[model samples]
Target: MDAASWDERYRGAELVWTAGPNRFVEEELAGLPVGRAVDLGAGEGRNALWLAERGWEVDAVDFSAVALDKAGRLAAERGVGLLRTVCADLTGWSAPEAPYDLALIAYLHLPWPQMAQVLRRAASAVRPGGTLLLVGHDAANLEHGHGGPQDPRVLYTAEQIAELWRPYADVLRAEAVTRPVTDADGSHAAVVVLVRAVRK
Candidate 1:
């Protein structure tokens, strides 16, 4: 979706996503060394706010201005002064040269070369030995799991992400992880691809 579409989605009063960071994000990053971090496609800045609360200087980037505005307001309300929001299209966005200890791309789905392009941009942001973590709905989730984007074009596999990162980083973990979900349709498991790499 474009910025306008996302803006419309975020225009409602209630939060679109959960108020807290993604489960995988908190679990994987809680023990890592805290430093500069960036949350790409940061809808409403949940992960960014969490990082700020934990004392990491965070840049939350998203295309939607409305989402960024909401994030800014929440940061002020919670006194999280370290969170910064950037409104830009990720495909055309570039981070400062090797400035971050960690770069996170969560649930940001795009097709093919665009996905590769964004991944390259994100990888470029991490200093050597810094971490790059990506999480997204797995392609398998469409038929075997539950509740994610229905479009297969945007869904990806763990191996695919790891392969894309091969030139710039060393893969630490790459797998399809299952999480329990309880929606109105009853209990189900959502499969998501999780990949962690360290910049070379």
Candidate 2:
């Protein structure tokens, strides 16, 4: 979907995504010391706000201005002041002025080539010894996982993520990690593939 579509989607009565941060983000970033961070495609600023609460200065970038506005309100309500929201297309958006201590690209789906370019740019924005983390729907998610984008072209594998960031950063961790998803029927299933790498 384009920016207009996403804007329209977020202009509705409710937030499309949950208020909390992504589970992978919480787990992966829990141990890191707070520093400069960038959240690409930060829908509603969940992860970005969470990071801010933890003392990180966060830049939350998304295409939807309405989403950013809601994110700002959410941040104010939560009493976290470290969030800076930017409305721009990730495909053409410029990187932050300074090198970030951490860069997060969570669940931002795009075509394969564009995804690679975005990942590469995100990785390059990280400072040396910093981290560039990516979490998204696994390619297998469409067939086996519970919820995410249905399009296979935007879904990714651990190998693909590794290759995308290889030129700019060292692969610290690149594998498919699963998390449980609870259903209304009381059954449980796994969803999402988490890929994490640190800048060399």
Best by TM-score: 1
* 109-136: candidate 2 lDDT, tens digit per residue: 9999998888888988899999988888
Q: lDDT of each model, Cα atoms only?
A: 0.94, 0.88
Best-fitting candidate, scored by lDDT: 1
Question: For residues 5-76, could you state the per-residue lDDT of candidate 1 as single tens digits?
Answer: 989999976699988999999999999978999999998999999999999999999999999999999999
Candidate 1, superposed: residue stretches over 4 Å from native: none
RMSD to truth, every model:
0.9, 1.5
Clashes of each: 0, 0
lDDT at 123, model 2? 86
Question: Model 2 lDDT vs. the true structure?
Answer: 0.88
CA displacement after TM-score superposition, residue 134 of candidate 1 (Å): 0.4
